[model samples]
Target: MIGQGFRGPGADIGDRPETFAMAQALENCSKNPIDPEDGTAIMTTDHAQPPRAREQFRQHLATVLADLQETAAQDGEAVALIGSLATQLSDKFRQASWSRAKDAMSADNYDELLQSFEKQGNALHQAGRTKQAYAVQALATSLVAGTQRADTVIAQGEGLLDALIDRSVALYRQHLAKRH
Candidate 1:
């Protein structure tokens, strides 16, 4: 039987019975050919690390949200810009996640993923975060200027109203004196 096994032109039946036993075990355990459409093994292999990847994505999203929130609290214009950019960033991340879930991890596809991330970072930077920092620094100056202007207008209007009231009272007093 051993000679028959080794007689196959290039067969290497070594002197080790353990090796033969292992080969027999592997042959016995071999599964039937898989159908292309039934990709359970592939799905399990690819999705094995999905939870870790999801955690990483969530961390990145949190960072983006925090940065956008800080920028939005500065001024109306900045809030508008940052809020829009944040929305775009969120859409890009969702697209990236969908792409990954679909197993489109080719080099070109990865490059697109990287480009999306870069665009989000660039948008965040350009959304006036730095300018918002400056706006915060100048907030006290703006408040003082605004308060002074409003106070001046209010004081002038109040003074004019007081003068009008005084004149009306004087006129009424003169009318009463004449009636007496």
Candidate 2:
């Protein structure tokens, strides 16, 4: 009913019913409500933007990861700093508008990455790696915040997410090395 008079056979255009029906279908898809939690639409409205956003996110993620790798190399134990970073991550995520990067990626991808960090963080905590655990949890929080923020500025968000993931992975690796 929404796109009825605009694109389908009911419209003024002399298009075939099947074609118009397909077009209507597409329109409906694009209009599907976004997931309130993730702020991404069920169907991407702009097909062209997703690839660009995804590529930009990937590049930004890479750069941040590189920076995080460097930071991890010079790692120190700063419990206060980790707590503050975690709080920042939470605040940023809560303030972000996720709709901007909705088509950039799938929720599963984000979930998988975040889950990995959480799993690693808990393990580290259980093994008496408090600093590393806190850091890893903060990293997980950053990924959500970064992805949410990317909707506003892709590069900035990607960089943040990338850096967080890189740091989290590095910490996890360090824990593994110590365990073995």
Candidate 3:
């Protein structure tokens, strides 16, 4: 929920500087947390992301696979489709991220740079350097937008895929009914 507790993404952030500042403060405060009872670590806001986010991503892929299996003519077809789609999407994601990173120092260092910026932004905020922190965070946002676009493309693809699934299911039911 890194972007949560902030103004809606659609809001005119430029029109409300105070809102932006407040959002930054709230974001920094919740970036990391500790379990109060057992004193265990709770959540982490590293570039690697929290476990819950990763789990949700896996579940999303599983759901898509399930839908594919429901519509595929055979189990092998479904497996092959998922494999192909996964490979294509991973390549696309890497390409997009690398395109963004190319002008910067080096493609391989892009991830490390993003993580460094994020950590530095948080550190600057803690040090009461809000303006500098905001600037650094904005830079990080720009770098990450490429991968975010890849995710959005996948989501858009899912929407179309879901429509196809619905149609396939309907046709399947009709065929079963006719057999009876």
Task: Name the best candidate (by lDDT).
Answer: 2
**Candidate 2 residue-wise lDDT, 1-180, digit = tens:** 111222211124333222212123222222334578878644332333354444543443344344444544555443233434443443344422222222243555445545456566546544545455445533543444343332445445555555444444445445546889
Give per-residue CA lDDT, model 1, range 1-180, as digits (tens).
Answer: 011121111123344232111112112111122337853212111122234433332332233234334444444454433223323333444532221222333333333433443343234224433332222212211111111222343224323322322333344444546889
Estimate the TM-score of every prediction: 0.23, 0.30, 0.31
Give the worst 10-residue stretch by lDDT in candidate 3. Answer: 1-10
Query: Model 3 misses residue 19 by how many Å?
Result: 18
Model 3: lDDT equals: 0.38
Superposed by TM-score, candidate 3 places the C-alpha of residue 76 at a distance from the truth, in angstroms, of: 59
**Cα error of candidate 2 at position 156, Å:** 6.8
Q: Name every residue pair that clashes in candidate 1.
A: none
Q: Rank by lDDT, descending?
A: 2, 3, 1
Candidate 1 stretches greater than 4 Å from native: 1-49, 75-77, 83-180
What is residue 160's positional error in candidate 2, in angstroms?
A: 5.9
